[model samples]
Target chain A: MKRIDLDIRDGEFISLVGPSGCGKSTLLRIISGLEQQSGGSILLDGATVDRIRPRDRDLAMVFQSYALYPHLTVAENIAVPLVMRRLNTTERSLLGTLLPSAKAKRKEIAGEVGRVCDALSISMLKDRKPASLSGGQRQRVALARAMVRKPSAFLMDEPLSNLDAKMRVQARGEIAALHRQLGSTFIYVTHDQAEAMTMSDRIAVMMGGEILQVDTPDQIYQMPLDLRVAEFIGSPKINVLQAALTEGDVLSFTFADTANNRVQAAFRPEAARLAGIANAPLAGVIHHIENLGADLFVQVMTAGGNLVVVRCDPGGIRPAIGDKVGIVMDEARLHVFGTDNRRIEGSYRLEAPL
Target chain B: MTARSFVSSALRHTALLLIAAFALLPFAVMVSTSIKPADEIFSETLRWWPQKLAVIENYTEAFSAAPLMLYLMNGVVVTAAIFFLQVLVTLPAAYALAKLHFFGRRLAFGFVLFCLLIPYQAIAVPLFILLYYVGLLDSYSALVLPFTISVFGIFLMRQFFMGVPDDLVDAARMDGMSELSIVWRVMLPAAIPALTAFGVFSIVTHWNDYFWPLVAVSSDKYFTPPLGVMAFRNAEAGNDFGPLMAAATIIVAPLLCLFLLAQRRFIEGIAFTGIK
Candidate 1:
């Protein structure tokens, strides 16, 4: 990962958001010390934990696979980290059960496990094995294991990816609520931008093995510093149209033949409006319309041969597939990216009359 | 059942019964001959039952013929020791070969596979000479030590361990389990079926082994069950088929009981490796 400079604050819910194979999971593993980085050193609470073992780092991790011990029951699985931390080797053996101290420690651990299980609302599943539980239950067990220790930080790597869609949404809310209650640092990694946006205090959008931008979710959605971040953060994807920037920094979209100073104009589907084909600046034919209960997303194939999605109110201007339309993007919301794909800073109004 | 399926099922059962009888014929003869008197053996009319019963006499003679009990004890001690040692050695080696990343792991595993190709008989003479040089000839160590590091056991267990997920190992590490603890606590519990399968193979091979014992030891005190059968044949039990077969049945009875006791686990172990 080149130039991945991220400083996660204590008690901050930070998410490393990116597409798959963008080294997000690798970065999480490196932070957890399960993987070694080639060059950079990791700092944990002001100390360099580069040479420390994963368990010694006082951090908890929730894996994508919910890597609970299949052989152990839910209670025992949750009790593992605590048992390892508290009990000595002799006290953990079978013969050690006869010792009074070991027995008391074990009972204390059972109580701790019970507390975490209750917190996750999985107290009834404490006696069951992981295989017998559902995917969501297993996820809860994994979460219970990570949360039982009350470590310095929690590192989750797509913890909800294995669940169903409905379960993922529910789990996303629970994890965010859990972060609030624990008030410990959480570094979540996910390919789903919606998850990252909903759960993170600050989302670090990564691409091609480098962190492109890091900001609050509102800023990431409103003013992304990189074009890739803008494209990746929104569902139904942001639309891009090829255009040229003329002199005096005026943004022109009508003429198609001008090739000098080419810039890609991008906007979210909600930021653009669909109007009549006669008076709007950019004319196109309605390619497809998606009705999602309260909103209609109209995919218009512009005359310059670019497809743009414009969100429409379901109660207003219902257009069929073959109808001609025009896309009038909000001038202030249009992000202009230069040829290098970096966000260009400007406030150029549209040349066409509104 | 349909008539077609009934006929096919009948044909299948008949074929299976024929094969079963063919396999069980030697055991049936040994049992039947064990209870027969000398006159019935030479009667030439192939009688499974004798005109006069000699069960008590044959059993007594079988017991009194040679030091059979001592040989059976030796078999137990040696086979148990070998199996225990093989498990102790093979598990860690298999876990390392299957899970750990290090230099020459592939080369080490290749050596194990290469050793699996070499038959025990091929190295017997050299092993015998080495035992003699170490002054462990005619000793229990000679019997148990040579078979301790079973390459076949290592190969079987390594194949089984390879199917175990790397995430499980990483989780164990994150849970603060040392590598050795992970082997014993995690890999060992997960490898039960493979261990049972290896146990059956190791016990059967070592318990009935005759060739190695014959070449390595000259003392009667170190004779295994098969050696006892040989000694019983040579020591005043010549031409006495009744007591000989009785002794043979006695020698083989323990293994039969063991196989029966572990029948379910043995089958489960043989049909292994779906641990997901």
Candidate 2:
């Protein structure tokens, strides 16, 4: 009985991000009319698409596997959409027995193929079959195919998830550029936070078959609407330390019955600072350090049996393994989630990004 | 090569050759004995080669004994009818059985398998009586109707259709194609090998099927080639074995040619049909 209440304006580049099995893929399929949602209807540009066949829906989806028809060559695969679009029922009737339409459908298709291939920089791979193309090349062909249709919207589901890390980064920029170039509504789905962060103008973070938050990427990262969104939208997996918001707005944390546990202290690793204070605000043994030359993510196990990751500079000094490090995560950057697993009321007071 | 290895290789080849000769002996004897003059057949000694090739003479006489050209036309028409009819019916049924889900679907498919078990002979008399009542007896309808729905064709197509990725079909669906269009354009094109294999099977089965033609067709003009081949052994050729073997050779040659033409397709199709 759930509903997808989408009011995304045309030409918006929206990324649907979530963990696997969160139904982001199902949502994409339903929108494209490939599948039916048992209850609610899907509308395309103010028109109901519930009864429309997927081809007539004017929606093109680039599947996660690229779903390039393995039996078809690259040109033929890309040409499928155009063929379905232009060829009338008569012209396609059993070997074109019905008089062939003398229209310029072929010329139009050729022009479309040329334009899209150039945009995707894949003109050289026009006739090659999908098996001959590398992964990156296949991705571009998928993009070109989707773009060639000139559909009202493009539906892409985790298109970059199949590429290697470096290629994914390059492909990310290209997809974002393509979205802008077309100026069409793009509903994309991905499970990677980095992908969501780098490419999307706005992201709809879905979890457990529901959208937890839908907002611009900066708003999602800085002012998450849900506790799950806060944890899901960031890298180094945001640390969730159990604590309480006590009187006078002071947040304190502890782990035992004899100790007082209060407001939940959630913060990104880079927000925390390290100092040599004797009675440290937060202290732990330096357990695992991932040094990326510029910045280090030092994973530390606190005395309370909670793991707090702190990002520190590796400039001219390296903290020895197992050595105790005193750190204070900036209070202003901390986000608090309530017992209900919702963001604590009035906890996020940061400026909302435009 | 080592002595043992060489001996084993030779033994394997010798075994294969023997098996080949064993299988081919009747055919060789039939062709050889067919052209021996009527007087020399059943003589004290057997000859492996004909004194003269009398194939055209034998064929012309075989035609004269029966309207063989009419029978040949009938065989082509019936086999063609069966083959094309099978392709049409079984493809969509196979697509439905392999892909779609509806109420009582499993039961319906089980019934198709059950239909496979009901032998043609069990229903042939009943079918004839039905055809007689319906004014279809002695007509092509008798031969075509009862065999229109082929369980073997359906089974082969369904198995081959199973290996095609669900996503590919789903993609076609998403592309706005109806279920039937998907079957014709996507599924069938992808199943060319299977269709060819089943085409061969269907043609051979119907071509060699003399019993049904014998019962369904009382008209000599409607007799298929295999049924007409039966005319050679009438008492006129008693101990005149030459003509009978020539007819047998003709009967078997078409099957050999068909097998050679579709051998690779048959092997690959059957092997890959079970992929799903």
Candidate 3:
């Protein structure tokens, strides 16, 4: 494997988004020193941490399950990292010898813990045990525990995935706010495109074992560099139509000389719209319509025998299923993937999203 | 009572009462004679109850007749030392066997399990000779050290530890805890019920132990309780009944106190760890 040339930027939140088994978790563990990479170097703060133990890695991770200690109350669980750092071996074990000064450390840890807990709105639940906590509370305490450590960087792996939808919405903001407030580097991993879109300063889209593109979430959504990434990042999923570059950027579709005849063209749902056939660039039969509360995405079977999904207002009337409808896409939003399955990265521009 | 249904519940209770009576009979006799004058024990018929209470006198004379305090102190020291050292030695061994991925962990654990099959009686001679060679023959270490690294304790703790989630260990590691601290903070704290249960088993078994201690310590000054009980046979080569029953009663009290306090933990420990 060749070396990865990543910019070791400070105070940045880098999200690694990919399907499961993409080795994203393994990569995070390697960077955290919980696992060693087979053949790559990880530099943390410009120092190699691959050989160091996880305890010395100057990093903290909140797990997917929130990994709270079952034996400990939330307060004690949150204080574990602080206690591990501040106490000597004997002082840690003896109950009373350190209990006096432990008050002082407790006050300080509690203060920091309180701030994080309050930020996460888990302050009232601090005295309860983890077993008694709801999934969201445990997730918050897990975050507070990780945050109170004040590590040089934070490594989180799908921290919000365990919560209910409402709690996930609220927790994502708190975590993003915490990253801003602390100004520390964060390496987040999730399969959630929305989480990646909303939280990260930059998202690294990984596939198989390699990073396909590392860019802003806007760049990832609007201008994906690979066919797999474009198909992966949306809800109704970006529709891929069989298309080709016939004459000097004037592309058409044949569907079966498909041999290297430009296998797929991809576009976001919002990139295409219904147009009257007299003025439409493409024609298709309306096959499916998904009406989300605020928006509707209508899927159509194109003339070339591929589905194209278009996003529109729920207020507009939709074409009946199996009804032939004309579809028009902004030419610039059209993306062609060559037979090699890589995005054709030459010049094409669409009108920007209004 | 009628003959048919009369034997149903009533006979069931009668049979249970007889079993209870059978089990309690020896204990009743021991307590009865321990408080009775010695000559009455051999009387023509068994006395259902003692005619006189001489428990105080018997107890006082029992301790005064020998170094009972010294015997108890030795027993306490040996049991406490073995229990403490057993925990100290077995905890790390158990954690390493359960969680650490060493090159020969399977082979090592199998070998540790192999130690279980070797009987103490078969190895007693070599152990005694080794203690004698090291000049630890009359010392408490001779009695305590051989039993400290308990194969059973390691095996029990390892079985309990295998249930702990690997993610929890990884979380501890990510929280900046050293592996040793993780055992103490995370593993051992969560393992208390099972440890207490094993502790009771170890204490009760070692407290009643006399064979190894008798073989290792020839000096009466280092006598443990059961060995102290054996002193009765020695003192009664002339068939002196007065002191024999008293010493036997003396040997039984500590075990009673230990069990009464730890009985709940003792029985439940095996089920708690879900291991043998």
Q: Alpha carbon lDDT of residue B154, candidate 1?
A: 87
TM-score of chain A, model number 1: 0.98
Ranking by DockQ: 1, 3, 2
On lDDT, the candidate that comes out on top is 1
Give the better candidate number (2 or 3) by DockQ.
Answer: 3
User: DockQ for each of the predicted structures, in order?
Assistant: 0.69, 0.52, 0.62
Whose DockQ is higher: candidate 1's or candidate 2's?
1
| Model 1: lDDT of residue A266 | 89
How well does candidate 2 match the true structure in TM-score terms? Answer: 0.89
On a 0 to 100 scale, what is the lDDT of residue A185 in model 3? 93
Q: Please list the residue runs of candidate 3 whose C-alpha ends up more than 4 Å from where it truly belongs after superposition.
A: A1-5, A70-73, A90-128, A242-245, A248-254, A257-260, A274-289, A299-310, A321-328, A347-354, B1-66, B174-176, B237-269
In model 2, which runs have C-alpha deviations exceeding 4 angstroms?
A: A1-3, A69-73, A94-100, A258-263, A345-354, B1-25, B35-47, B50-60, B235-240
State the lDDT of candidate 1 residue by residue for A196-277, as single tens digits.
9999999999999999999999999999888899999998899987777877576778645845878888899999898876
The stretch of ten residues in a row with the least summed lDDT in candidate 2 chain B is B231-240
**Clashes in model 1: which pairs?**
none
Off by over 4 Å in 1: A255-258, B1-10, B49-51, B273-276
Query: What's model 1's lDDT at B176?
Result: 83
